[model samples]
Target chain A: MTGPKPLSNLMEQFQKLPGIGRKTAERLAFHILKADIKDVARFAESLRDVKEKVSLCSVCGSLTELDPCAICSDPERNKGVICVVEEPHDVFAVERIGEFTGVYHVLMGVLSPLDGVGPEELRIGELVARVEKGGVDEVIVATNPNVEGEATGMYIAKILGGKNTLVTRIARGLPMGGDLEYADEVTLSKAIIGRLKM
Target chain B: MPLYESPAVVLRSMKLGDTDKIITFFTLYYGKLKAVAKGTTKPKSRFAGRVEPFVYCNMIAFGKEKADLLRLNSCDIIEPFGLVRGDFEKLKHAFVSAELVDICQKERDTNMEGFELLLAMWRRLSVEGDARKQDLLLRLFELKYMSTIGFHPFLKSCVDCGGDIIGPKAGFNAIKGGVVCHKCITSDPAASRVFVGSVKLMGKSLEMPFEKLDRLKADPGLQGDIDKIVAGFVKYHIRRNMRSERFLAL
Candidate 1:
């Protein structure tokens, strides 16, 4: 037996959210149905408000309430070092670390031939134009350490090969508290190859 | 399902949804496998670096009841071979090798030699120093891969007539599966002329076991022919090109 058309429609919408599998989606839909009327209205308003207000920064390709993201507008930050990443979420990941004060150029995606995502599909040309405009000293590729990520990272390296800017890849190594014997070969080798002298 | 574990090389990996990855591996006992690495895309994911391509890791994977693809749980590093990712040329060779096994091999098909050959080549690329030297091993690895999958190309004899390659320039008929004799080259229009030196070195490389692979030699002049023949053979037989090569070409 099925619920009313509106309830089923709500379930379908909930299912569309990221990481919400069928069972969890069903649970969420039921929870929404039982929620306080005012609270539900606020949640729905927030979703619509975000969609209307959030816009991609023209300069850096990150989602922001304003045109140029704060990072791009902030003169205090290091404009010389631009950390290239695949998506805006990655910008958040780097920001959480808080060690990096450099601005970011979100590529929107990496070069993935299988999925038909090439350099043109990404924000690579904009990145090059930004770098070519001058004042950039280095480009640290912070794309994920996966195949497409690495390929995208290297593609950035290749494009900026001629410029005076120093190009580099974010180091791949073991996570905190990880044991040597338990590390994967690829990660272990990266750690070994990237080790610093004490 | 019971938790299964094996030493596997991360041949390919692609994003699945937002925070997951669908990874392909060439494993030791289980052979080729496609598994889900949950949360691999997370910033501090436990599976980070373990699921990256070119990595050789001891993987623990399990399936939920009757699922086709296993869920990758945790992994221990067996060999990262970091230099392969550090150097552009080395990275290209690694991708081609990984893509070869990924495209050609069938699931659950156990080919121990193929597994070992991949590991050995990655090991070589780790410190091979010269990019050309690292690429040289890929040719041999491709040959070995063909042999494992039961399409071993004939290098010594004509693929068409099983006769000797008589001329200084050996013709390669990728369609016919290997070198063609002077007489047989006329029989196959698809056959293209390849240097005898390339054909000869390929045969010698295939004959030697993986352990002594370094001893095989080819002159710098003949390297181009060797590359051509190998590329032709792989392109024709495999019918799929390595996508990574295109990025490297750029």
Candidate 2:
């Protein structure tokens, strides 16, 4: 035996995940160690399955167990409109609403020059090729209302310019449950700009 | 070996291989700049708050060519733009503004006006009650940006016949780059139509700054017209439709 339990190694792996701190990692490692063998096996199996089965769709960059993904393969979804999101998580988030009838293109990540992630690092060239070749009518940018995401959206919008495609971005303002009195000036202002007359 | 220092805002930041980070900056002097802050991601690294996104910092950098990615020798945090960090709406609006700077600013081109505009916008939003001014602010940036980049739309004269035009109402031809006289409109097959009233609104928008705009009550129709005109102008010059603008409009 190489000394203490492999808790340190497990914690290190957990820390690699986004938003997981060292303390959380330790807690997770301990939880996993104390869990039933069957549960542990199931967790391990799921992780393996995700890696072994999941691959990017050729049409959109969404992770899928099969090529083209279910959404891209589906005939019912609006082929004319494509909702573009920054990551796969956004794809799931939108899907949860079940409101968007259009298909999607997962950008995988947004443009962040500070991080050295640029146009080249992103799937932008692929998006252009898709736009140029595909029979797309409108492109809805569903990226996070953040700087990198906005930059990415702008870059994509410029690239797909005048190709007969109508490009759009999600409106930002007050949240569903937000109180107007508690809302700050920026939020209230954005809400007013983004308001839809019911 | 000369070291230059300037004020910059972190547009975005990401962790590099092991301990370093890559930060994209909208700088006061250089416009858009990308720098590798070595060991920035580490706990003890000096670049901690200096390179964080949405934070403004005064940085010292060393590089041979202007195009060469600079090495950050030192960074002192200025205004953190802290109001943007946690607040979602503020964060989003600030990001859109920052992204505009990133897109409009040419690398190594010193655009002090654009820099000042960004700083002013940030400062304004950081204060209370600036939200009602959001639309005006964005429009202001678009107008100022277009002016700075030499794409100021022709609002007064007939772009085609060079006729002395009346203001408060006019037509716009994206192809012709200004108010298209009724005679000129009939001549061009692809020109988009605009109203005389709409043209006046556009004229007023183009002439006035954001501060003056906030106090003035805008006719909804006029505001819509101005928005459309500015949108079309931006689309024409940027050579692409802004996807976000459309979605946000929706």
Give the candidate number with the greatest lDDT.
1
Candidate 2, residue B7: Cα displacement in angstroms equals: 1.9
Q: Which ten residues in a row have the lowest lDDT in candidate 2 chain B?
A: B241-250
The DockQ-based CAPRI class assigned to model 2 is incorrect
Off by over 4 Å in 2: A1-198, B42-45, B128-132, B164-169, B195-198, B205-211, B243-250
TM-score of each: 0.84, 0.54
Q: What is the lDDT of residue A43 in candidate 1?
A: 99
Candidate 2 C-alpha lDDT tens digits along B1-250? 5566889877766667777777778788777887889986443455655576777788788877754577778777778665655443455556656656666677777887777767766766666354435655666567766776677778777888988665444567766678887777777765666667767655676676544555544466665766777777777777764433532331
Index of the highest-DockQ prediction = 1
Residues A1-198, candidate 2: write the lDDT tens digits. 133468788888899997789889988988998999999999999999988999889988898988989999999999888899988878998999989999988877886543446576678788778788878899999886545666677767767887889898788665676566654343455567678989
Q: Indicate which candidate wins on TM-score.
A: 1
Candidate 1 docks with a DockQ of 0.38
